[model samples]
Target: MTISIDATHLADVTDFLQGCEKVVGSPNVLTNAADKSAFLTDQRQRFTGAAIAVVKPGNTAEVAAIVKLCNQFKVPLVPQGGNTGLVLGSVPDSRGNAIVLSLARLNQVRAIDPINHTITVEAGCILQNVQEAAFAADRLLPLSLAAEGSCTIGGNLATNAGGTAVLRYGNTRELCLGLEVVTAQGDIMHGLRGLRKDNTGYDLRDLFIGAEGTLGIITAAVMKIFPLPKAQLTALVALQTPDQALQLLTLAQGRCGAALTGFELMSDLCLQLVAKHMPQLTFPFSAHYPYYVLMEISDSESEAHASNLLEAVLAMALEEDICQDAVLATSSAQSKTLWQLRESISSAQAKEGKNIKHDVSIPISRIAEFISVTDGLLQQQFPGCRNVTFGHLGDGNLHYNVSPAIGASVEAFLDQQTAINLVVHDSVHAFGGSISAEHGIGSLKREELLRYKSAVEMQLMRTIKQALDPLNLMNPGKVI
Candidate 1:
């Protein structure tokens, strides 16, 4: 491996770019501050920074040269793909010394081997286009999300993103069979085979998937593809409590089998927020239960069976007092209407107030306990804190959010962020859960991750980071 960056050679980055322009064309590189400004800030606008330049490598060979040049100059390189990452992994540093290597120009659908039921795509390919390609081949990518239209495959793989379909098809990492990465020194790690099983010597592909570019830049990937579901069933079940939501999940899972694709939980507070903030959407069910779960089960079999399964589950759950009331979507449009209630939480919350949220995870069995305990704890600690809880209950991840007190000043409430974080994270730790669930640690949870991670574990992370990015050039001041 090439030695990392040194402050002494920092001035030579411009010279390196000058040399690159001679070889790889001037149009590919970006040094202007305005263009780089948008590249630096995150979607949340939480963290912003500067980069020496944004290098748009048009192809694999060009990317390799940019990496080699950066390596020789010892310039920190931040590999970026759509720049849609919630985490600051794709953003550059405040120092404005490290180069941002943009992979967007490498967009290509190299192969779609429908025979093998696999698609080989470059990292920069937009996720929507990937889905379209798969659809054209009469298959579904099955990794659907709100950002699917804008996010890139590389970003998804890097974050190991868990979207709506994660309960069924799995996250980005699980869908992956192989990968192609650009090492710190710009060498390609190409092992793009659609192999179902391979007992390779250490799984190097898995390392780069969720490393947040601390290890290597994911250039391309070979991901698993699944057959499109023939029929889909969506339901809105009003539950009395969180435990009932769990029971509904169990009942749905029992009947639907592998087709139980999603079981998303929503607090009545969430629906209220959605209705209050988003005036366009009307509630499918009346304001009744304290909790609700929007579930979708898809099968290649029969819609009748799937509907029957849901009805049976709802009937049993209601009879046993597991759920208060249930309503199945009579049409696709109605189903979408029900889904919109769950999907609009973030925007609704944003409009409501400054959200003090914790995206944490605990054991499935401990979910009921966690919900009950956390609600009480929040009420005790911060008397005015409103507990707006919801998320993928089946996967044991919940967005345990504590909104700013209704009557209190926002700044004052946000002032206790650190203390509030400790309260939530400590509870998560008590349950053997990660400080972060779906979202990457990014700038938000870096300190929390350090606090929760054991000394030995933190040391290992530091070592790996040091080995890959010695100068700390890639997405500096974030993650590890």
Candidate 2:
């Protein structure tokens, strides 16, 4: 007997879920609101949308089946992985009409080719775990970030994440060799060959890699690995301003060339926050400066040589007044400690107050000018404000964040976020910078992206959005 019922009622959705779960088994589908709340909310709680049910598909076929059913029922889908995204991309909307399709159970390492140096992994695999697997294989999966512990490979690929290794190993987009996706109509596009040279027509791999789930659902990926850098050196430099940091970056590259893998800038206000929040660090610099840079240099077998080269660069930078002082990590432990100070800025800022964060980028040559211009404009506009400047300066990206004046309530201060972001992002525009650097244009910057992106770019993105997701079932109300 064929049974039919209403689609909007909770019982109707639950009934539909029961039928969907029959294809996979009993443990993968959920309908209870309390149980699904965790999946509906984002990591930062900034975006919490409603979900009628949460579905966990364990494999490619299962994901396709779920998508087909959702399409037929007109239930919007939200594809989620580790829930680590910051811009409301993975979460549902306030409408509560969508359901999250969790990909965690799809976790698997299908194969590892140590010679060709690639690892095929399911989208649900945690990033750090993938790195560990590569490490065990005596190779390196160089894409890395602080959230590696929890963020999924799918999330990183979906956003085309750029982490600490971008200087040496480009972003996640460069590291990925191929992808396996579940189309909107439940067709499996199994583009899962580890081919090194395939000039095969349209590179579909690139489309799904950074589509943010607007085009299709990614189930797994083939990631490129590398022979590990045999030697590495990390150091922290003290600078008086953004200009000094910029000069120090130039000196390091000129001195070490390709060996320079990382160059991150920080601020005194950031350090103060670290010391105030995370006490493990003792502040290595002799004195505090307005700006700082923490960087790493790596080579095939030149660990000691790289250390010496960094010291030589530091000397020249100091003499040239590009840096005030410096501290080179002598041991791995000390290097990690130095990194802790740099990495703790985000957490410390969260504790301080509502920080208006701008993960922006400008021309590599115009970083210093962008900082100076934006700093002056911000200070003049929001007097008595604390502007904390820093980021991966080597890659033309900066986390130009600002905290409210001391003791200001977040309730009142947040109202001006729009006006403040306008001034800051406008300066970024004047410098020919991207409003959304590596963070991807999630709902947070959806409007801001429009302000910076040209009409032609927006039109192209919309065309792609319409082409791949004509029915708009794949993570609707996000990106384009």
Candidate 3:
């Protein structure tokens, strides 16, 4: 059902507010501008929207009741968690005809079964908190990202978030065992089972996992966990080019196999920016290289064993000319500092100037080609545009970002965003890659998705959307 924006019923905010208050007490319904301001904007501050009220519900029952009231009053709903999304999927629209349904108050660890390797957590629990809970139970929830400190599990599942560990533990979809969701019509579906081998019909759990709240609101979930690694080995290696990095990855994988947990790639330009902006950070090597790889290996054995394995792999890589230089972290603090160099790329880029970012994934074999081709094309068309590339190379996902030259006007560079995106995304599509790897198709890429997705695929998605959210009251005008 395609629901168009209409302001005719917005005048009934008073009654809607009263209904919401009845569902989740009056104090939880924030209507003032000051109270709703934080929920109205996205993490990047790229988009600011309006909402009739920002409602916080404390439990699944309250979430159901609040959703039920929204449906009854014909009010649109935007289910938000942490508001940490890169895409504008979590915020309300500018029309102020919707309600921002916040699940922060619903956060709680419902259950933990170490033997079963599953942890049941409420939707609003922070990602880092979930990781810590798993650690407390002698398990590991490996869906890690830089924003884990602020991003919520529900948001992670909603976006099907892919982080550095995707090369190993897989995305949020794979990490999840079951989900307790409130349907578009406000009916709670208690499907939070930790069974690993359920041949259930239609796979309803998956439908809502990456739906971005267009079909339903995720209230809680049971996620899969793994045994905690006894030791971790981190290394920062310099390479002449991406091809060399790729070779190093293949070698490391063959040498370490399942112990290899992370393989990140960054351009020398990225490291230079980090050095210039973040003077306190220490680089692994004194001289700069064109590319670098931050690789990590984890095992259920002694630290010495893991380190020996890593040293052996690095020795092979060096002898084979796959890497120019390597630094094996000698201590936990040194390992953290090496990882911080890779994690600080985004912040360093922000300090440079206006930038165009693309979260794309291509075939592992064609990653180097994609970078080379796109970089050349960008330079040719938009002269002086700096390309700062880095990402989870092991998973074929790259943050292929471009920024204007140091002295260029940010506004002028932003004016050409559409053209820049066309060049970058067109190359990604030609390489048989997805335009959005971790981030879902929020309003940012809705039109691009239509152009790229096959007609049959789009039709199938619409069919599901119609079947589940006929009224289109749940996060209308986003995703599909």
Q: For all candidates, what are the clash counts?
A: 0, 0, 0
> Candidate 2: lDDT of 210?
73
Q: Please, what are the lDDT tens digits per residue for candidate 2 over residues 229-310?
A: 8777888888787878778888888888888889898879999999998886789966778888998998776677777888
Query: Between the candidate structures 2 and 3, which one is better when assessed by TM-score?
Result: 3
Off by over 4 Å in 1: 1-11, 470-472
**99-125, model 1: which lDDT tens digit per residue?**
788889888988888877899899999
- The runs of at least 3 residues in candidate 3 whose Cα sits more than 4 Å from the true structure, single-residue gaps closed, are 1-11
- Give the clashing residue pairs of candidate 3, or none: none
By TM-score, the best candidate is 3
Which candidate ranks first by lDDT, i.e. highest? 3
Candidate 2: residue pairs that collide: none
lDDT over C-alpha atoms for residue 304 of model 1? 85
All predictions: root-mean-square deviation over Cα? 2.9, 2.6, 2.3
Q: Rate residue 211 of model 1 by lDDT.
A: 78
